[model samples]
Target: MENDGSAIALEAHELTKIYRMGAVEVHALRGVDVEFSEGELIVLLGPSGSGKSTLLNILGGLDTPTGGTVTFRGQLLRMDSERALNLYRRDHVGFVFQFYNLIPSLTARENVSLVTEIARNPMSPDEALSIVGLGDRIDHFPAQLSGGEQQRVAIARAIAKRPDLLLCDEPTGALDSKTGVLVLEAILKINRELGTTTALITHNAVIAEIANRVLYFADGRIVETRQNAVQRAPGELAW
Candidate 1:
């Protein structure tokens, strides 16, 4: 279950994805081989329609690959049943998408509590919010909060489950530069404090500087990878 210092927390071997549109087939991913490790933050970068999102979706169990193997924690992810995949996502993975997805009517605390209620071993909503530096905003409704605050609540909700893996697809896409930096700070804090293995999908090259490793995608394949000697803080990143 442990990578033991190996940068292989999650791995895909010859992974591929194909979509059938009538008689025509679209290949979204063309045999990608990659490995991500524990206690590291990784940024998946690519242009629009480059399959970065497709790959992130597959890794997060939102989509299935059509070919090859996916292994997480030494267990085969590709062959998992729906029930198993659901359990995997619930018990081990935390996901944050671009949209906040917070309930319009629910206060931030209530929104976060919804997940902790279902989680097997969860941090209290208060604890999660505090970690995201939103301890004072718990009583605020999404509509009453700023876009960044709502997104922070969304993040608190995801991490409240005490998940081992965090998958973010364009988490900062909806925020302005300053707000995005705040969101990224919370993500970085979680990565540093919990040692969670995290993978982020982003179009911004600046975000890559915050990652222990960066993977650049092009035409459904990884075209490059860069390893940082040390990840920089969100404040240190340049657009």
Candidate 2:
């Protein structure tokens, strides 16, 4: 892809990751190179075990590539030190996973407050919930809300920190198609409103329609990349 001179939010050069268990080696990534532009929404589509999650983890500073370089806004990310990576993740990245991972005992507002409290600069929990269209449910507990509602709470929690990057790994994997669209809509809103650079991983090919860029992964590599001239709204997406 040709860069039109937009600032790079994140860039990976020849990224590779290998895991070893008792002399057995697993190559999670194989020389993957990619770049994410500032405020761009990207979707990664692939089958399970194709390394989409691994790539997302690396980009979000949750995991280090065994070989390769990852840079954020022109600064090289050093993964040799856990403290550095932890700081990077805490200050720069927000992650949403397949599961909501909400504290069962905490209300929706309280769950998001947990992140805001530790963040350098954060929005009020109520404001964050409202951004995700969950202001009315802020006082509700996880058990009281539906699966889609719970995921919106998770999204609110992530954006509460006001991180520069939002990484979502199958954010809608656990929801029904109708419900998943709601979750995607929340993510889309965050990216559009807050200008957070976003990367999402999903098995559903249809979700790619909403992304500015779509990367198709297979065998730990990005086999194809498609750029959308006009991105679709989350509500316009079917399944």
Candidate 3:
């Protein structure tokens, strides 16, 4: 792996995460080492119980590794103070999940505004919505939108904070292939226009073509890493 600190956005070294379930020990991660650069889109591919989400969670500061180091832009995160982690998560990391966790009663604008209200420097909800091609549907409720539109709203909410990184775990899992492609396009646009570093975790191997780098996991270990010479757009993806 290239070790030039200047270009790296996130780095993890020998990361290991273990969970104790009474008398049983669950090793969720085993000596994983990886680095992601700014403005790069990376896909994490794995099977169930493969620790793909575990790695993404750790990278986003949502969870701490049992034994390892995670650094963001040269700032050591594994041992950071709780307050520091909180600030890091709030200010720099954007997360999108398989489910659109939007407030059911809130309009799309309001949902995006919720995060901007607490951010140190945030884009206006309208601006964020426009970026996701939701400008005209800003006042629509979650129930009024299609699955793809709802996911775009969720994406707008996540990026409203102008975060340096976006962590998505199965972002398109809830949508059909056509709708999922739209959601993926929004993600791709965010990375292109906003220059946000992105990590997407998905079971679909086909999604890897849309990423600049791809990581494959199995049995709680990183089994392979491949860099794409050319990334394809969502519509160009094979699957």
Candidate 4:
């Protein structure tokens, strides 16, 4: 509801994605059109097969659309070129998934260091971990952390690159409500402090209160979009 004209972070026009299996065609996205403003926090709610994941993949350059166009900062995404997509993903996007894909042997700092080492401009692993409220736990390995802390480590890894866009696919899916809220607080902090455009997908509608806007997806399309005039903190959400 509130757009301060910070510039458009991402735009998708009539985007469609189709998957084929034998004679069956699964339409993942149906000409979806959406925009994510810079520094905005948007939440996506949907059932399974609702196409939110497909949209996220396309936006992050992890997948291409079957038709239409998607762009970042007004630059058309060369979805057809793997090299271009790779560069775009590496330089601009950050992703956090349901699972914490941290290396078992690496400490939290070391896990975050993986991305900072390769990024063009990145914050130190210590700073990244601090942003996620894990500074004191930097010496702990993945095996020593709890589910939510591990997820924060994953978030630290993603944002250490100072990515302009953050795409989260069920980042709290594995944790309980309390733990999930902690993870969300970390996300909220990043979006606010870093001015990162964020898009989050989740099945739990309660989490929607924490977003600036909410998009409901059904049958491969966004059926409703709602704006939160006053955003709620993650701690305020019970489920």
- List model 4 lDDT by residue over 203-226, tens digit each: 999999999999999999999999
Residue 30, candidate 1: C-alpha displacement in angstroms? 0.6
lDDT of 1 by residue, 101-200 (tens): 9999999999999999999999999999999999999999999999999999999999999988899999999989899999999999999999888899
CA lDDT of every candidate: 0.89, 0.94, 0.92, 0.94
What lDDT score is found at residue 71 in candidate 3?
A: 91
Candidate 4 Cα deviation (angstroms), residue 149: 0.5
Model 4, poorest ten-residue lDDT window? 1-10
* lDDT assessment of candidate 3: 0.92
Ranking by lDDT: 4, 2, 3, 1
Using TM-score as the measure, what is the rank order of every candidate, best first? 2, 4, 3, 1
Considering lDDT, which of the candidate structures 1 and 4 is the better prediction for this target? 4
Residue-wise lDDT of candidate 2 within 1-239, one digit each (tens)? Answer: 55557799999999999999999999999999999999999999999999999999998888889999999989999889898899899999999999999999999999999999999999999999999999899999999999999999999999999999999999999999899999999999999999999999999999999999999999899999998888887788886
Per-residue lDDT of 196 in model 3: 97
TM-scores of the models, in the order given? 0.95, 0.98, 0.96, 0.98
Question: Can you give the lDDT of residue 43 in candidate 1?
Answer: 94
Better of 1 and 3 by TM-score: 3
- lDDT, candidate 1, at 15: 83
C-alpha RMSD (angstroms) for model 2 = 0.9
1-239 per-residue lDDT for model 3 (tens digits):
75335489999999999999999999999999999999989999989899999999998889889989999999898455788789889989999999999999999999999999999999999999999899999999999999899999999999999999999999999898888898999999999999999999999999989998899999889898888888988997655
Which parts of model 1 have CA positions greater than 4 angstroms off?
A: 1-7, 78-80
